[model samples]
Target: MANPRNPNRLPSSSSSSSSSSRSVASPPLSSPPRITTSSRAAPPPPLPSAATPPLPPRLRPPRAAPPLPGLRGLRLRAPGGASLHRTARVFPSPSSYEFEIKEKGSHLLRLHFYPFVARGYDLSSASFHVSASGFTLLANFTTADPVLKEFVLWIDSDKLVLSFVPAQASSFAFVNAIEVVSAPKDLIGDVAIVPNQLEKFNGVSRQALETLYRINVGGPKVTPFNDTLWRTWVPDNELFVESDSTSKTLSFSGRIAYQKYGASREVAPDNVYSTARVVDGSDSNHNMTWVFPVSSGYKYLIRLHFCDIASLALNQLYFNIYVNGNSGYGDFDLSDAAGHVLASPYYIDFVADADNSGKVIVTIGPSKLSSPSWIHGLLNGVEVMKMNNSIGSLDGDASVVLVTENPVKRGFGEFVRSILCGFAFMSLLGIVFMLVMRLRAESGRTVLWSPLPTDVSGGKWGQGFPVASGKLEL
Candidate 1:
């Protein structure tokens, strides 16, 4: 009530002196003007703390395994009962023809003619049959029906070659020109048959008119079929010859005393030694036997040709095998005696035991201590087959029979102990048939609670004991 008017009246003193003169002209406000906030220099210290990481070095141990190459397991045998399933064909003609021969009847063929034609024809009047659609050759003309113009035939499995070229004019010539023929005494040999209507005929040459007839029948021959079965061992002073048509080369020698693996040192020729040479006919005696041809159940592979001559330090020789004559080293002791050395040339494989035994004996030496020791050996060829099957006889004589041994694989703790004894005999017969059906359902629930206490007499629990306990609980 006394306010408004009174205050208004007081402030009117020049508005109270201009509100105390604007608070003394606000001049002493230094403290309020000191508001200077420009101090944020704390971000330059994050580049000096990085050096603590060095730990990863511990895992080194595993390196030592290299020494296994010494004819680990050897076996070799194959020479000449002859049919391990033989097959060889090379022909330009030295005369040999075999269309089929798994063993027929008579076999004796030998020819080594190489003079390049001096005039020789009559290869047995030429006629060999084998039917089944193979091996056929026929040529025999006198004159009247002469018209076979040009001819060149070749065969191999035995061998055959024929060459003839005629036809230029025609009249009738060629008299006693039989070159050579032999087969049951068909013997013929003259050489020079030219007359098919002569234009410029003599005996080869019109630039030699493409003529090359060579025939080389059957091999491995030296009287009496050369009695094959391969046998040759050189050491007894050496001097060999099974049959060498002069310089065909089949020589062998013997001399020993150069063992270093067993001490008695003297080494230099490049240091490493083992030598053997005898392809088929050398006789000295370190051991060599061959007669190969087995079928009864075919499976064969035998090879050996250990030759080490410019690096001698020998001491690792042990090989002894014999098939057919039996004795494949029984009670263990293939006899290494104390030798097992090798530097090269070693091939071995064997499988043949179903009774087609013909022959195979080999004995490489130098083991009983191997020193200056003395062991000479040679056997350059052996190969009995019947492996890939398919040649001919299981009953007729071509080849088909193999099963020599290598079948026994069942060990993982005997296949987990036969599946844990067949799952413990079927889980012990399913726990004895569930304990005999829980003791026959607890003896039929104790005979339905003792016949429901005698049918509760009357009604309460009776009625034949609730229909005989609900038909014995179903």
Candidate 2:
């Protein structure tokens, strides 16, 4: 008989008990639907379409062995949840897993590493390097908390091999579970727009991407069970910068309308579009902003999901979007973009460069084009994924050189600021030049003017212009 499942008793870093050998207790009550273990390699079973409910992930056990020949397979049981996380395989030496490819195309490779203490071993200290086919996924990776590394890689051959090597001979490697599922055919688009530059980024499907953040804006957390892609989406309470008083969360009761040539459920579940965070029309001082810390200097693929759940009619809501303070979309209209449909799902992809401060900021504000009565902003979801650098590495091994034809266009506010700065600099120069001329006149020496324009007059440059303005507002 299976014991009752306890969702609250989650796994932790340190376990209370230990044994000389690996402990293989009874499987958890909520085990995965199926676990395929065979002497031969097998490809993961195909999942249902996005319209159907998501089932438990089909995982193929990795071939692992301990250092000692006679030791039992190193496995530990988790107290609750799926069997995949309940038991983990520890590797004392280098190990590899070969999976047969059923469909040769882009596939999602997910590696789960949950740190725990069992059998007198601390899994958190295990340092390792992971590689898929030829691309290096992780190197010298060790973590105190559980982490799920997701990669979208192209599988051209019939077999896809994943190698796990320890950092050193004395060190070890371990993994809780592995998932290699067939990704959507159109998951990675061919081109992504550079937000501020407004240029097309071609060949985006060729590079590998690592999932950094999947945020459900203004909604509760959406776990894998409710998601069509078996992906987890976290709430935006901590990520969003606006307070509850300034912005409010809303949930829609109607069905989320998915249209052709638009974002489908495969891209993101309906749960994401059914709820939104909308700014208060009265609060004109602030915009709805979310910040995500990431590796500096790497280019990221930012996917912003939108739905008009807050509006009662078409063309009633409009807003502006910004990425890292750069203008992504100026006065974006939800109804017009979605073919005059309400509650329709829409998404935009932007290839943006992460700031040196190691953060990506997304902001949405009420647009001036909208009616005064409907002045507000809203968002549904946001997904930030890291694109592999030039050297084909996700984890900062080689510096990613930013290549762009058109530089970011400065805003009107910035142009105004620049003009003011130039005026200030010229005024200071004119004062210094006058002082020098005065001293030369007292000494009875010739004061020759330079070839550059030295006259700060009001003739052609603007009549009686004040160098120091009264008030310069942004």
Candidate 3:
């Protein structure tokens, strides 16, 4: 449904009591910061003592926000790390905050919610609808602690509207903060990827560019203040089930990394190259893997970050990559891939269409290609992004091709007469054996398709240690 926001319904301005609450002149702006203003009026004072001279309108500052608890000392802080715990504009009734963005392109909108007692807020009654520019960002959502979600928006105009509406009477709706950041253009198109239809729907576009996880594998969290582009890179420990049991993921000593995805300069912090996740005693039969929890059926663009900081010689380390049992990249030797270079940034991007399990199993194992050199697989960073295709592609809606194209059956006679006959027979057996191994892995493995064990009815907040409950229950 379209946004039903009526500015006339905004909460009335509250009285000012403190010196900081006093307003200054609405700074001389060529134009207002917000194109749309609230439609509420300030409360009137007792007939403004007839004995007093009327004050000039320009001299009077705008009415200050009503005094409320949990609001003091909580000013908006710079956004970079896991969103801060304070800075809020609480809503007792329907409320809205509007902003104007001059840049027109794909933009990422971040909403922060912290259900604390800072503003006499009823944490249990925090159900509400959140919308941006008349589009739904969150609906009837409730949480126990601080939570943040990011969305990719394609803004065509400068005017933007963000609003909150309580779901039930007396239920207060509030926001800790909001942010709008520039995103890569063409990353999201207006075309919708309708299933069963092979083409873009009506030539319109769609984007599934919401960020699910951006992590600095094996490293500490990097806040926007320390990052190159004010981006937040969380540590992988928070989300992955790692095979390594060590107290720390293996460490590396590589140089700086420079990366560019689309038009933006997405640089990995220098610290990003200092650490990596490397499992010991890994082999070709079973590779070390990390399982991430995700929603199923949606398409994802999984990007891997690498920097040979270990100073390994040429072909010193070789590994194979897998995504949900499929070969993401086989026999990937980082140094060889980089032309035997070191201390430089290298990355690979793959698009995966999730299946019913909703989980993506990523494995990095020692490959025969590097077995002669003797080393293990290691990773520096990772990003799993949702895709927004203008064509009829929604991740799972994508089809996989397993058929192999080969020379015509002039081969049928060649198989019996050529020198490759013995070798070809062994190759066939190898394929069969690999198939058996894959089947065994599938049968032995469990994937999560449901909520975590700590998932409560109204919130997914942490409780005790989160244990994997086998595979998702569909």
Best by lDDT: 2
- Candidate 2: misplaced stretches above 4 Å? 1-82, 243-245, 398-474
Native-referenced Cα lDDT, model 1: 0.23
Better of 1 and 2 by TM-score: 2
1-474 per-residue lDDT for model 1 (tens digits): 211101111110000010010000000112121111111122211212242111112111111111222211111121322221111111111121122222222111211111111123322222111111121111122222111111111112332222211111121112111111111111111122111222322211111110111100111211111111011112211122223211122222222233333311111111111223322222222344434334354333333223332223454223344444444322212112213433332333333343545433333322233223323232322323222223322212221111111111224445678999999999999999999999999976674433445546444765443444354454
Better of 1 and 3 by lDDT: 3
- Clash counts for all predictions: 48, 1, 12
TM-score rank, highest first?
A: 2, 3, 1
Identify the leading candidate in terms of TM-score: 2
| TM-score result, candidate 3 | 0.54
Q: Residue by residue across 309-406, what tens digits does model 3's lDDT show?
A: 65456667777787776777777878766656665567666666665677766667667655533556778777666654433222332211100111
Model 2 lDDT per residue over 227-320, tens place: 5456677788667785623888898878888888888777888889999988756765568898888888679899999999877788888888
Q: Which stretches of candidate 1 lie over 4 Å from their true place?
A: 1-298, 301-319, 322-373, 388-466, 469-474
- Each model's RMSD to truth, in Å? 48.4, 19.1, 29.5
Task: List residue ranges in candidate 3 displaced over 4 A.
Answer: 1-87, 92-95, 118-120, 133-135, 168-172, 184-206, 238-248, 257-267, 279-285, 314-317, 336-340, 353-355, 386-474
TM-scores for all predictions: 0.19, 0.68, 0.54
